[model samples]
Target: MSGLPTVDDVRAARERLAPYVRRTPTYAHDAIAFKLELLQVTGSFKVRGAFNAVLQLPPEQHARGVVAVSAGNHGLAVAHVGKTLGIRATVAMPESAPARTVERMRADGAEVMLLPTVAEAFALAEERRAQGQTLIHPYDDPRVMAGQGTIGFELLEDVPDLETLVISVGGGGLIAGIATVVKALRPRVRIYGVETAGADTMRQALDAGEPVTLPAITSIATTLGAPYVSPATFDAAQRLLEDVFVVSDAQAIEGMLAAQEALSVLPEPAAACGYAAVLAGLVPRPHRGTLAILLCGGNVSIDDLVRWRSTLTV
Candidate 1:
């Protein structure tokens, strides 16, 4: 499979994404170091793909507009891009989504369709396909994967000596893209995916040697709630990627706290799951080489924040 994003594709993605997205900072020090992804447009890495994907659309495609499904980041991403590019977008999201995110999407001119779950939101995206709206996959398209691959391009270009890059896996886009770039550029550099144990579709797929779908899941990392893995991406990881690890909701929350304290970035549980890997010793420790963890998303429910605050007391 063509998991490796070509150097040309990386360059093109850099050009396509340069206008709206930040070149998110790469940080290093005596201890753990990483890319400051909260600097991303819409406050997460999703913006890179959203901006590039929507902007790359032809006039006809733009006119048809775009639609996507997400409980958090992807919805905001497409909505944010639509505002910048004048493309009409609709985001179908679960009703359980944080209010702050829903309001932001609405403010950006995207029609919000609230459903009971992320699965239903995806179904709604399909429903709109009949109306000529193109699907902006949350994390499945080759273009989006290529765009996310730019993260690796930037990361490796800046920190090629990195031994292990820890990234949170949602719908497999970020890991797939980053893995492709790292593997092609420095095959020895390990790429490990950290996912919420509650929704480990990619992990399941890797174990099964094929994409697998879960029946149901309940994880605080709503943005990482991918029930099924994409065959194309799964095959890539199966062939080229390194490892997949799982983290619990409590560990994910702890990682989120570490993000707020160490990096001053309020990452969502899924975004913080990568750090949870370090906390739990999944990537091994007492090493010398650099480790780049993607800070990922900052969106969080007020309730989740309150819960995190309460935990600080006990």
Candidate 2:
């Protein structure tokens, strides 16, 4: 795999995953546009990467099974893909992950191990790799980033006049892939990344000129709570991304509520970061054309939604 996924890589991934993943739609609300990746198969864009990575593996490797580490969405996506491809999957998730997310992964037939933290989950996943399981990293792998890049390909096709693309960053696979494709296809179109203030991995990585691990991730947007950005993702962001912005947890909740009110969708806090940036005016708007905000995932449970709703009134 290359250090960065090329446009050809994304195109190939699109062809390979055409039948399995949805070409999720984009819609304009007010002056801003939204890419509804929350409507994807596993209720998140993570499935695109999951399917791409799993399908790329040799058929013989399938027998050894696959392992992954996730706060929630990535594990759920991997579990869903493993079931569809008939491979056994074991996911190491943080013990603090939402119960609904844990239950969803279990329902999809993955053996879910609850680790004490995200770092520990990754450590356990590495150990499982040493034990012969194929490790499908959530965001660090090129194949996975190529898969996520397919969304950028779709965006250009669906919204040819797009002037800027705003995306939420976690471990950076999603934005890395999208930025690579978008920049290649339309260099003039700016790409921006958003993260919760407490979990600003990409911002810190860019500021330091290298990937840095945070001592702790304290954001309510647990899905965007990657402790460190991977080298590939960090490199991609530096080369392609125009700017990175941080929003408070409360602003993210407000963005979630705003999306639900305007588009009738309740995005998880991580997915809401892009919208949060817009709503908070943390990033500059396009002067001449439409800005596309990626609504990356919508995996929050009804109970969680109610709790988030209460925060809005407070």
Candidate 3:
């Protein structure tokens, strides 16, 4: 196949990843159905890509180990994959990453490095990659995207008449993979990507007609703070998604609180922003079929929740 993951590649990924990932269930509430990826292993859909990226490596490379850079969830996913598969893993994360997530990676037996910024973490991971360690990129790889595409397969099977899908976009892997499958199988399904206001990587990329880097990330949704989108992901979003919506951090917090009240599930700001778009009337309600929003992660800590509640008047 080409650099982009094909539908057939996604099908193979589903079979290959069957043993490592969860087929998260969808929950219907009022006008929307939520794809509860927050309940996925590692508290996010990132594990699907992590496992697929690592498991595909030739056995000989396991000895050379692997390196990855992430804000939090992807690091946790890579660490967990390393432990489960008996491969050595090292993760570089920004110092601003959640403390609980850092501890989890260490507890999972991966060497964890704390850098001053996300860009430094990426640089560190690149240095390691140049030294022969394989880089299991968070979103750029076709294998990782194929793993995420598995969610599209499940979504279609569960909601056969699904008319619309709203997904939170970070580095663009999640929406790209899902849109590939959803559009391939159900041509008319409208897919939209969402981002918190300060971390609108894909939206900026869309405007530039190519992937563009942000000056800095300022959203409370730290996990959504990718510096830029990959070309493949940008192309996929440009070709497949109906549009990309940007929601404020305050609005995302409101959506988080709403989901907690309605579904009794607490989601991180990154996960809640897509639903925030739905709540803020950015996404149109589907007339005849299901409108699904992906709750992509639930990695927020109690301390963070308390802080958000005290500061943000939601």
Candidate 4:
């Protein structure tokens, strides 16, 4: 409960969240199996953690309400969960967060406050917590990580012969949860994490042998732009993750476009980072079996997509 979530913890979370979230589907193309988590209820896998964390709160705590800080997807998830459970929710997001993301959170009935930066959003959330609101951290909480681990549970069940799992790392919650479960269940399955070059918090943490905050992060994949990795997530990644790689923003955009064209799904840059690593040959090709690439989110606006697509060179 304190450190990395166990397989049992993930299993329990899966059962706890069975009614609220979707199982999501997996499909194979070429040698890579795509876990289409973008199809998830809130347009991202964060809903798994959001629902799990919110539901675990006592009724009185729920009445007290919840507060969270997110670049985008986590905010939307928390907002959606709060609306579903009839809890008051407030989300602090950066001013630079995509307009569509802000609109979605507002549409879900959360009081959205736009701060100067993601760091400021976290500070605001902490302040709100001091005022008695239940704080739902984006990635640092064990319960949230346990909820995210449910994705690994589904992956293993859907593809029993899965040889490798490529996941995009933000604050490391998603990969940490998944790696803990996958390593425990299938020790031979290699767990790899991907990050955009400028926002590689996990890679930086692994290199430093501890978590460190960056002065700034700049990536088109705003969802992957955590300033630092949490101690719990760092420990889990160090012990359980096989390797971590980084992809350029250009590569991520290319992967996004490719996924849209081939898979008929528009993946946000963070979601496409892992697939970008594969496409760029940063990850070795699996010779004997299949690899699974987690297409984690799809929350881009058409205008943003058009702008990104226009950047592609001939």
Candidate 5:
């Protein structure tokens, strides 16, 4: 099967998911325009992929319901899917998952199981699978990847002359999917993948030339702290991306601060990962064409954010 995604697939996803998802906004930053994917339905880009995965499931399975494991965004994504499909949902989330995020998932009507941490959440998800629950993966699924590719399509539509597209990697769903479309449609565009310094499973995976699970994840940016990068995403990224990079949680904080200072936007740590690349000098500012970054989400607690602001170097 071809690893590339087409414009038609994105168009179909956009149409089928129109009522359920948000088209979001595209912001122009002098030289570049960003898709502002953080403005998507669930306040995260994952909603696009989650809805796509749910829609792809067999009708019976959709009716049977779905389950997922996430640090936060993916769980919220699945919760959004459940709400749209009127399906029962059980999301396994780490106990350390942000309180605001946990409440948001509940608001979306997902039955959330809070494990000790992300590791335990995965174990709980496997246990749920044995109970006949359909798993709507956050990543590592073609349907999900195709769904996220829609973001790439939107970017292309907004900035036909885009020169660079930088994305933050968790399980690599966002970048892998973006690369799938952009590399095929705009082969000249540079694809840059960013990961948190300590939680850089995807970066490590690329360096080793294969997927490798980190023994543990440690980062203040909880949402982008997936302990492992799936082989499927690694393969696609290795083949399509220009480079894989890493940044510190402090850098992610800087990214968030940059959005607030420069654009007056409130961005979550996960959504801010792309700008982390710019701060770390991993990707340069394009002087001619667009240098777009995928802002993945915006669901931070005001109190926690206030605290981050006090200590952030931005």
Candidate 6:
């Protein structure tokens, strides 16, 4: 629980989470194998970590309830987990988050607190934590990272001779979790990360050799717009990833549209970032083995899509 999660932790997380979460499928589209995590319960892979974290909490802590801060998907996952486990949940989310996601969290009976920015939302959640509610960090906790690592287990089992993996990096939780497992199982497999231009938290962290906070979160991919990556995630990114690629918001939108056409499921701009990198040829074409991209979430609404599309011309 203190250090970075081990492969054993991730394996245990998979078993512990088996009954509670869905094992989302993998699909082949063109040359890229897509891990359809958007089909996960609460519309993202965050639920895996959310469930793992909450389930491991002591009974006394569960009674005290849990609080979280997220752009959207992590809040939704925590809200859904709280509802299922009969625990009171509170989420402080940025006002810029998708309206539909906010509504869904409220529908799950979680207290939804909207702040002007993600940093302010984190502040609110910390205040609530000081008041005794357990803070379920979106990306910083090892338990959550181990939970997210479950995806790596599935990917190796599903993709035949997978050579390269691409994932969108936010606070670095998803990539860290998956990379831990992938590198442990197949050390030769090349693991890569993607970020939108303005929301390049991991890319910046890797460059500076430490976590660096951005001045603003300006990307259309709000889910990938964490202002800074944590030290734990930064360590993982530095040690495990082959490279981190930065792409434009327009390219992410194009990838989202491509996913919509190919898989018939519209991915959120953040989710499409990995695919966007691949499509833009930022991730080299796999010459020997399969290249897989994670389509991580699908929590966008029509209004959200329209707003995101505007980024193209902006």
In model 3, residue pairs whose N, Cα or C atoms come closer than 3 Å (at least 3 residues apart or on different chains), thus clashing, are: none
Assess the local accuracy of residue 39 in candidate 4 as a C-alpha lDDT between 0 and 100: 98
- Tens-place lDDT per residue, model 6, 1-314, is 33579999999999999999999999998877999999999889999999999999999999999999987888999999999999999999878776777889999999999999777988999899898899998888989999999999999999969999999999998899999999999999999999999999888878887889999888888889788898889999889999999999999888888999999999998999888888888897877999999999998887767876775752
- Higher-scoring candidate on lDDT, 1 or 5: 1
lDDT string for model 5 (1-314, tens) is 12434556766776767777777777876555656777778778898888887887788887678889987788888988898789989999878777888888899899999988666888888888888788877777777877887887778888888998888888887787878788888888988888887788888988888888888777767777777877778887888888877877778888888877767777888778788677677897776788887787887766877787687655
Deviation in Å, model 2, residue 230 alpha carbon: 1.1
Please, what are the lDDT tens digits per residue for candidate 4 over residues 34-64? Answer: 9999999989999999898899999989988
How displaced is residue 314 in candidate 3, in Å? 1.9
Model 2, span 1-314: residue lDDT tens: 43778889999999999989999999888978899999999899999999999999998789999999887889999999988988999999889887888888888899999988777888999999998899998898989999999999989987888898999999999999999899998999999999998899999999999999999888878899888999999998888988999988888888888999999998999998889888877778888978999999998876886776676552
TM-scores of all predicted structures: 0.93, 0.96, 0.97, 0.96, 0.92, 0.96
lDDT of each: 0.81, 0.90, 0.91, 0.89, 0.80, 0.90
* C-alpha RMSD by candidate, in order: 2.3, 1.6, 1.3, 1.4, 2.2, 1.4
Task: After superposing candidate 3 on the true structure, give the runs of residues whose Cα lies further than 4 Å from its correct spot.
Answer: none
Cα lDDT of candidate 5 equals 0.80
Error of 3 at 35 (Å): 0.9
> How many clashes (backbone N, Cα, C below 3 Å) per candidate?
0, 0, 0, 0, 0, 0
Off-target runs (Cα >4 Å) in candidate 2 are: 308-314
Better candidate number, 1 or 2, judged by TM-score: 2
